[model samples]
Target: MSVHEEISKKTNKTWGIIQTYRKLDEKREAEIEKVILQCQNNEAFSVDQINKVTEEINSFAAINHLPSRKFVTKQMVEEAAQN
Candidate 1:
């Protein structure tokens, strides 16, 4: 391939990464909301429950190579659910 073609290919790849990052960020926020709602309806709101949800999200992020949202504690869930 020509130098110009190679540069264009890399530019497209960079753009794809940016778009994927944006989409993943939005998805992560939605996932957090879903987790909070699940906890709100559950019988008990505990640290373990929060940790389980956090781990699930983090695992998903890991697979996607996105930064994990650490420290999703029970208190954060409780406060977010109220809003």
Candidate 2:
């Protein structure tokens, strides 16, 4: 597959996984977050832990298509507000 196609496939997979997680009860989401936090707090992360974190982070990131608000300038916000 081409690079673009490969990336699209991976993104779709991540999005599907995230949607599955969302469909679960909220408690499960909280539990998963707790586990993620625990894994992250370890001094050294295992390869599996790293991979899981990376996947979840990427999946969460895929939820948004817009650029980060951190990059928004005061002028940009003012202009937007004026509209």
Per-candidate clash tally: 0, 0
**What TM-score should be assigned to candidate 1?**
0.52
lDDT of 2 by residue, 1-83 (tens): 89999999999987886665554324334444444454455432223433444455445545644211122233433344344
- Per-residue CA lDDT of candidate 1, range 1-76, in tens? 9999999999997788667666655665666677787777874544554455556656766775767766567678
What lDDT does model 1 reach?
Answer: 0.68
Each model's lDDT comes to: 0.68, 0.47
Model 1, backbone clash pairs (residues 3+ apart or across chains), number: 0
Give the C-alpha miss distance for residue 20 in model 2, angstroms.
0.2
| After superposition, candidate 2 runs with Cα above 4 Å error | 26-83
TM-scores of the candidates are: 0.52, 0.31
Predicted structure 2: clash tally:
0
Q: What value does the lDDT take at residue 24 in candidate 2?
A: 39
Q: List candidate 1 stretches off by more than 4 Å.
A: 42-68
